[model samples]
Target: MAKRVLILSSSPRRGGNSDRLCDEFLRGAAEAGHQVEKIFLRDCTIHYCTGCGLCSREGRPCPQQDDAARIIEKMVCADVIVMASPVYFYTMSAQMKTLIDRSCARYYTEISGKEFYLLLTAAEPDRQLMLRTVDTFQGFFDCLEEAHLRRSILCPGVWNVGEIEGHAALQEACEAGRNC
Candidate 1:
């Protein structure tokens, strides 16, 4: 069976390590016959969450009238949501974090039961911190009715474009994608 997979890539550099990982993952998914869509956050205009809570209260749905809401809609439509970002200061990029914060409406209604995968790359290779970041997703995503976290790929010590060219784990990431 083919699944619709949406990948939100937050890397600003083209063909960067994070981008390469995403490409590998998508390639595996495509080879498995799944439909995949990758959205680059750097090219999109998305604002940070204002904490207005209007999306949860008045149903305003993301006060920032930019591309954030549309992206969320794509996320809702997909069977799997893969967030690929380069970690900054031991956390996800601001672009990725902002999009997640702005997706409050989905927390309650839209994508309540959707599956999610996280792909994080960092300059420092620390499995413990990367696992912690993956765990942080639980706070916002665990409440969904039937949400399942299939995998979280943390490719560390990659800070340049093409740095992951010959990394062995990249193959594992592709395999992970096939299973998605």
Candidate 2:
């Protein structure tokens, strides 16, 4: 079965290792016959959440009303979501985190049940941080009745642009997408 997969590249740095990894993942997934679309965060205007709880009360959605909502609509319709980002300060980049925060409407409405995966690169070369981040995602998806984590690929120490081109993990990510 062909699945609709959305790849959200939340790295503000273009052509960075994280973006490269996301490209690999999308290639792999597409080769597997899944429909894939990638939305680069750097190209969009995504504002941070204000904790207004507006989504809960009136379904006002994110107040920013920028391109993030458009991406969120795609996310709601996707069968799988791949969030690709670089770890900053032991967490996901601000760009990605803000997108996640703005996704409160999905939670409040419980309108979609979708699988999610994380593709991350970091400078610290620590695997635990990646695992913890994936765990955080796990908790978020726990609300969906049939949601399941597909995968989380963390390629640490990829601190430079295009540095992940020849990495074995990059190839693995591609293959994973192909098989997805």
- Give candidate 2 regions above 4 Å deviation: 61-63, 108-111, 143-145
TM-score against truth, every candidate: 0.91, 0.89
After the best TM-score superposition of candidate 1, give how far the Cα of residue 59 lies from its true spot, in angstroms.
2.1
Task: Give lDDT tens digits, candidate 2, residues 1-180.
Answer: 999989989888888898888898898888889999998988998887788887867867556768877877888888888888787776677887787777786562452567777888887677776776666666656755677677788887677788777888788779878877
RMSD of 2: 2.0
lDDT of 1: 0.81
Clashes of each: 0, 3
In model 2, pairs of residues that clash are 28-177, 28-178, 29-177
* Residue-by-residue lDDT tens digits, candidate 1, 1-180: 999999888888878888888888899999999999999898999887788877777877565778988898898899998888787776677888888787785554578667888888877777677776676676667656677888888887777787888987588779878999
The best candidate by TM-score is: 1
Candidate 1 pairs with clashing backbones: none
Q: Give each model's whole-structure lDDT.
A: 0.81, 0.79
Clashes of 2: 3
